[model samples]
Target: MSTITVDLNSKVVPAAQKIWIVHPGRNRSHIDTFESAGVVFLEFPALALRPEIIADDSLLRQRIRYSTAVKANKGFVRDDGTPIHIADYPTAADTDVSVHLRTVKHLTTRMMAGDLVIVPGRGAGGAVLFGEVAGSFFPQKSIRAAGLPFADTPVREVNWLTKRSKLELPAHLVKFFEKPPAIAEVGRDRWSEGFFDFAYDAYSTDARSWVSLDAPQYDGSDILSLVPPAELLALAVSLYRAMEQRADLTGLDYDQIIARFYDHDALAEAQMRFQSPGRYNLKDKDAKLAKWINGFVALALAGALSACSNGDHIEFTNKQAPNDPANAELTAMINMAGQSAGGAVLTKAETQAQHAQSKLGMSAPATVR
Candidate 1:
């Protein structure tokens, strides 16, 4: 929910394109092939997941579940006593693995021309390289190794879009470089008009200011806008709860514990558990995913509170958020808003969103009036 400073007033809006973060390797072993061949590729799990099985999501998931899981009976037998094919193991139950599976599937089937790609610094170095997926996915059989784990694997052709290295990466996108997936979509919420415009045509940011939370609009801020209505409601509930917890704490207690909790959920038990990050719904068990989501939720709730407060303050408004949060995770969000906004606390904002409340199985606050 933290507002960005992308060129919000551009006369022409760029088409919303799918953005992907791809890591060439742990040590960037495939950087050469990725650039020279003008392509990006995914690492295959098993030799059995060929074009046929990999093409089907259901089959892939089932195959992964079997393949990654331990089989008590040994040597791959099915629940129905039929011999399970080694190649067709179900996709693993792990979210990252599932996402990785989708990456493989997406590059082959979902990725299309003009879709954007961000090759990590490890592959491109100090600056990230932005490219456009330009051609079809290559699933040619590679005899060099089984399951295509080498430099030459399944690939999708790309055309480098930006000629100059983007040294000053947008802050929101820096996290991806630190802990990237072999393949994962950049959540629509995180898309930046500044980055997109720059990647596309070298749009300048000389005239814009860092959009404050209280700004009347943040149109190109895809993260908040693209969030599903139901999830947004859930996020709202989490924010109100966080506000309450911060309210009761005094001075150091508020600063050290309450504020710190929501501000850095990754350091604690990250309460927000969404999947595929920015786009999908909750998945509590994914530790890495939880860490990312809670941290993001903290920022979002903080930003929202800050925004809803009076304009011109550009900092926490002078009111303390009245309602308490479920834990420190929520408090950090509230404190971040309050501390930054000159100590302005957010009023409790519960909901009449019966559908969302019913689905989430939690009480919501009334609107902050």
Candidate 2:
């Protein structure tokens, strides 16, 4: 069996506030092992997900052509074995029309930044949309009808954003964007599992640095820490729809196949670096490189979380920390201690708790002692 743990650490975020979660590894030993050959670990600062609302809906509908309705089978009704549209004659199955009304209601709910929307089109012109960019790109105007077969074609999908990728997107894609469902609403019982699925499926070896394999049982007893990639490039599109915006999804399976199979050699190289001795320990020359990598991750996240002068340009401008004397010393110590037994990976809850207590200088209580 294998196990994977995701630890979320912040300046002062407590366990209650923190979003730490664990997942069972691929090979389940009674359904609670973190052993998986193909798993990824993802960490994105909460700052990136600042919530904002869509101010313009008319403009959104113009560009994405989402307001256009597509015909869907209303299903048949029988009056003495005669088929008819629900409008022609209402019946028990007529309740099905309620589903469409509910869809419209759900779509009108408050839109937020980082939310994804999709729009369908002609043969190969399906477009994805981001709610954040809708108002800007489609500012109220007569939407130039992009002559595509999409008009009158019914779209079939959900209109919402989630932190975890369905299957194609590596776990990191969702992490870099930080669109997980609200924990309070989802409840703690299933939150960890749901979050784990998001973190695991949204990242890939091609674009993300960490992979998680197994699901380890977590009792929330210890502090598990992970150093994930600091920089990420994700592709999210924006579309205009129903005087509003919607998110589009391309097949995640296609994206994953392209990254994992077609680009296997390059992705393999990236993953291999994870096992190099200097990766975990920062004392060696690789430590500087690792620091550089860490700096990149921090900068990317900071850019996403911080208000940008121009949202399109993301700058990673804080790479000079290595030159500072105090930072250099700290890096050296981290490398040294990290290379020791202290760095050895431990999975059991007891082991993790003991490690956390030791680091905090808190003596084990009478019972543990």
Give the top-scoring candidate (TM-score). Answer: 1
The lDDT values for all models are 0.43, 0.22
RMSD of each: 19.5, 23.1
Superposed model 1: Cα runs more than 4 Å off: 1-14, 45-51, 62-96, 123-125, 141-152, 163-166, 188-191, 202-369
Task: Tell me the tens digit of each residue's lDDT in model 1 across 37-137.
Answer: 67776544332456676767766677555444323333345466876565545444556366656666776777767677877655332546678888665
Task: Tell me the lDDT of candidate 2.
Answer: 0.22
What TM-score would each prediction reach against the true structure? Answer: 0.40, 0.22
Error of 1 at 327 (Å): 55
